[model samples]
Target: MTDPLGQQRPIDIKAQLQACRSKEDTFKTLVMLSKTQPRLTAEEKTEDNKIKGCESAVWLIIEEKDGLRHFKADSDAKLMRGVLVAILSLVKGKSLADIQQMDLKAELAELNLSSYLTSSRTNGVLAILDKITSH
Candidate 1:
């Protein structure tokens, strides 16, 4: 299925992530982006609504507006937070079907992320996927 955010699948989420050049750069980018990106209200973010089984605290909020699934995510860990932004940028503004059909593992692998990620980090990615799929 085609991504709802135009024809581009953000097929380069990994490339874009790698282009950050440094983990600090990635974290800075995420923080800056999060500041500008639309966020879910506090009421929309509840403890029970957060992603479980993550080594770090992660919160995800999903909303289908105008037939598009929009995601907002945050994490306490700097690296995880950056990863969250990377993942969110790819899947955000997609249709439910598009999100469901996305092969995230393949995408990440193509981006060469798996080699750099730990088991916990890998699980964190899955947690992000779970949050997206849950909605």
Candidate 2:
């Protein structure tokens, strides 16, 4: 079965992450992606969409359609918005089963992001993952 993105194979998020030459490059890519993401309107950034556990105010929208999950997110912090996009890019438009089976920890480990993430940011990322994977 094909997903909405109509992929013959899963997008290799791990590989994309690993391709980054350095942590600085990763942040550069993240900033670029974040700039492309549309800013949230006041309504969309309300309590209903607010993401908990993030040190900064982050909001998320998760929806299931045609057996696939779709994600959209925003954050007050510039960097967090990029993290949201990265998280979404990895799991968005994937089948629920595929999403549930994803080894997020493994992927993050491969990205070698631990050195760059603070405790709060780490928790925020995990919280975002939980929110996406759960109801």
Candidate 3:
């Protein structure tokens, strides 16, 4: 699906992520995806946009246009940025109903990265998912 800004969506992100055979490969993919995540402007990094309950400072901006949601996010931590990109790949440009219906924890489990995450990191990821789905 095209994003609100009309950029082509990442190709089969689930497939790409699931293709990784090792944690190193997964981390590489996440880093690659992180490179594509849009930077939140200094002005846009307001407290209102910052995600609470995360160890790292994360800012998410969700814009709705033509009945679709567009997500832009950033984080002070690189791994968090990668995680945000992965999460955004799933929900960006989708309708609110579609996003709200997602089983995000299941999706992450499918990616097989759950073992790599600390409890705090998992909670942070959930915080990001909550921010997206709740919007």
Candidate 4:
């Protein structure tokens, strides 16, 4: 993935979120970034894609091809969509073992993201990570 300046490097969501000046700015940036991979269509947001433990409805789909996982996710709430984008960024194209090795909750803390979310929403973050890793 390329940064906004078009530098060639892996996408680091922690660094991206850390660059934001405030919660409001972080959320706005998240929404803007999410446009890179927008919400799903009605047909794709089926029950098979629905996620549990999210306060707002979220759907995630993973497709494995040529040994890499490609993810598609969507959420009903804007904030949750942001969360999904962040989490998905971390796991996109990773192998199953790589996903298993990740500590996403700790990474979220490193990004100062937990400060912006309530306990339930934080759990939702965990749930999303869990779904991805477990896949």
Q: What ranking of all candidate models by TM-score puts the best one first?
A: 3, 4, 2, 1
The sequence of per-residue lDDT tens digits that candidate 3 reaches over residues 1-135 is 545665436556677778999888888877876777778899999999998888889999999999999888999987778778777877877899998898878877776576557888877888888888887
| Model 4: how far residue 121 lies from native, Å | 0.9
TM agreement with the true structure for every prediction: 0.70, 0.82, 0.88, 0.85
Deviation of model 1 at 72, angstroms = 1.1
**Error of model 4, residue 133, in angstroms:** 1.0
Which 10 successive residues of model 3 have the least lDDT summed?
A: 1-10
User: Which of candidates 2 and 4 is the stronger one according to lDDT?
Assistant: 4
What's the lDDT of the predicted structure labeled candidate 4? 0.75
| Native RMSD of candidate 4 (Å) | 3.0
In angstroms, the error of model 3 at 3 is 8.0
Q: Model 1, range 71-91, lDDT digits (tens) per residue?
A: 766666655665665677677
Deviation of model 1 at 105, angstroms: 0.9
Question: What value does the lDDT take at residue 131 in candidate 3?
Answer: 83
Best by lDDT: 3
Which of 3 and 4 is the better model by TM-score? Answer: 3
lDDT of 2 by residue, 33-74 (tens): 577567778878888788888898999988889998877688
Alpha-carbon deviation at 57 in model 2, angstroms = 1.2
**RMSD of model 3 against the true structure:** 2.4
